[model samples]
Target: MKTAIVILNWNGQKLLEQFLPSVVNFSQNEADVYVADNASTDSSITYIKEHFPTVKIVENTINGGYAKGYNDALQSIEADIYCLLNSDVEVTKNWLQPVLYVFKNDKKTAIIQPKLLDFKDKTKFEYAGAAGGFVDLYGYPYCRGRVFNNLEIDNNQFNDISEIFWASGACLFIRSKVYHQLGGFDEDYFAHQEEIDLCWRTQNIGYKVKYIGTSTVYHVGGATLQETNPHKTYLNFRNSLLNVVKNVPTRWFLFVVFSRLILDGIAGIKFLFELRPIHTWAIIKAHFSFYKNFFKFLGKRRKLHKKQNYNLHTSIVWQYFALGRNRFEELR
Candidate 1:
């Protein structure tokens, strides 16, 4: 399979300098490497031209964030598989081999994510995507090797390849045909959780999203937008709600939406108690944005022929906080 490892960059010269080498070194033999520049104002473009002349550059006219950046850049590139790698991820040697093997063998698998470990520590799973991603009853996403703030150590327990509800945007491997067929990502979500929406739609169309733990990448999570950034908080909450509205089955839609509002309110209050009022305000803003886009997303939902069953766990919130189950293995 012709695989293109495209790293989406937005003024991340330092990240490119740090992590791009590993990607080029490890992935060049298995795939073509391209840095999809999102109209970066810094020396990112020039640096790549000078240091990594072999690496191609796709310069987008405007900074369209993650969704449209890839959509625009990939249109010019020809490849069977597109690896939408984050600029901050450091890929391991032979990482592309196992991922390529799976895509070639399993025609049903549309998207895949490699095991994401923390670049800072290297021994633990990263927050963006750990083993694989799964969503709870209310469209809350969590991973097998991560639950809320808890990240699991790399003990090889989640080494087996398995189907997942979503693949992390941090380092996603997806089929080109499937990606375009789904109309790329919902650009409405400028960033954050858009991958979950795409992966959920992939499943709805009878394709699978998998996690191949045999291949791994280390991610410097929150490089672009720190975890504490209110804007990140806003995008995550808003996009997650949009994901449910756009993809959740009609039968469970109302209940899920209502429950999420209540849960999010609780979250906001908790944030207030923790002296993180900005996050609380961000959630409030997210709810308003979600409300504003509700009808539009409902229209999107109406256009789909199928909405896959996504309530994998009953409630990750209840399991994690109330029941004191912080680990993935403890949930069941």
Candidate 2:
């Protein structure tokens, strides 16, 4: 099977210099590598041209954020599988083999996430995507090795394949046919939580999302956007709500949105107490954006039947904060 590993970049020259070698060295035998440059103003494209001749470059016309950037770049590429990799991830040797094995074996699986660990610590799971991701009934996303800000120490407990609700966009493997069939990502999202929306839609149309924990990758979380960035917080909050509006079961939609509003308000207050008023304001702005885009995303619902291999009802927020259950095993 033909697999294309496409990294999305936007003025990320330093990140490419640091992490792109591991990807090319480890993955060249199994798949072709491509750096889909998002109209970078820096010398990123030049550096790639000089250092990595084998790596193909797909230059986007504009600095479209993650969603539109990949959408625009991928139209020209031909492959059976597309790995939407981030520029800041350092992939391990034999990473692509395990992922390809899963894709080849499980015909029902449409998307897969390898085990993601922290580049900074090496012992703990990364914040962006740990073992694999899932969303609560309220549309708050958590992962097997991560919940909220609490990251688990990698004890080799998650070194087994399991089904997941969503795969992280940081290093996601998806079927090319499935990706294009869904018309790619909703460009309005721009960035953040768009993967969850895609995964949700993939399941809605009858496909499983899985996590191959054996294929490990170290991620430098928040390289492009810091965790403390208010804009990041805003996209996360707004896009999460948009996911609920666009994909959740109609019977549970309004209730979840109402509950999330209350929950988000509390979160904003928590940020105030923590002296991060900017994030609180970001959340407020996110809600306003959500209100603006609510009807538009609501129109995007595919009205397809979605049956899950896992439980649909979960409240990661309550389990983490109120009950003090930070561990994935504890939640299970």
Candidate 3:
């Protein structure tokens, strides 16, 4: 299968300078590498041209964040599979071979995520995607080696392929045909959790999302949007709610949304107690934003033919907080 590794950049010149070499060195032989520039004001384009002359560049007219930036950039690229990689990831050698093997072998596999380890620590799974992704009944996304903020040490415990609920946008691989068919991510998201929505919708239409642990990459999490930023919290909280509204089955919608609001309130309260009033306020802002767009997202939900209920989780919040099941293996 023809594969293209596309990195979306928006004024992330420093990251490109630091991490791009590993990708170029490791991925160029297996796939066509492209840097989809999101109207960066910095010399990201110039640097790429001067240093890596062979790497392709797709310049977007505007910076559309992750969802629209990729949607707009991918239009002209022709490939059977597109790896929507983040700017701060350092891919290992021979990473693409295992991913390609799975795609060629399984026609129903629509998306795949490689094992993501931390660039900071190296031994721990990265926060963005740690041994693939799965969502609990409450729309909370966690990974095999990560739950809540607790990360498991990489003990070679997850070095195998498996099915998952979603693939992290940090290094997601998906078929080119399926991506366009789902109308490309809901650009309204602009960023955060849109990948989960994409994976959810992919399954809705009868496609599998897989995690290949054999292929690994290191990620510098929160390079573009810092975890401490209130805006990041706003997008994460708001977009997750929108995901539940647009993707959860009608039978569970009312209960899920109601439970989400209550849990969000508790989370905001926890943030307040932890002396992070900004995050609490951000959650408040996120909820209002969700209310403002609730009807609009409901219309989006109506358009989808399937709204699959989650089959693998009870409540990640309760499991992690109450039962103290911070490890993925401990979650019931």
Candidate number of the best lDDT: 3
Model 3: how far residue 43 lies from native, Å: 0.6
Q: In model 3, where do residues sit more than 4 Å from their true spots?
A: none
Q: Rank the candidates by lDDT, best first.
A: 3, 1, 2
lDDT of 3: 0.94
* TM-score to native of every candidate shown: 0.99, 0.97, 0.99
Model 2 residue runs over 4 Å out of place are 302-313
- Candidate 2, clashing residue pairs? none
Model 1, span 1-332: residue lDDT tens: 88898999999999999999998998767789999999999999999999999899999999998999999999998999999999999999889888889888999999999999999999999999999999998999999989999999999998999998999999999999999998998899999999999998899889999999999899999998999999999999999999989988889989999999999999999999999999999999999999999999999999986889887789999999999998898986
- What TM-score would you give candidate 1 relative to the actual structure? 0.99
State how far residue 167 of model 1 sits from its true place (Å).
0.5
**Alpha carbon deviation, residue 119, candidate 2 (Å):** 0.3
TM-score, candidate number 3? 0.99
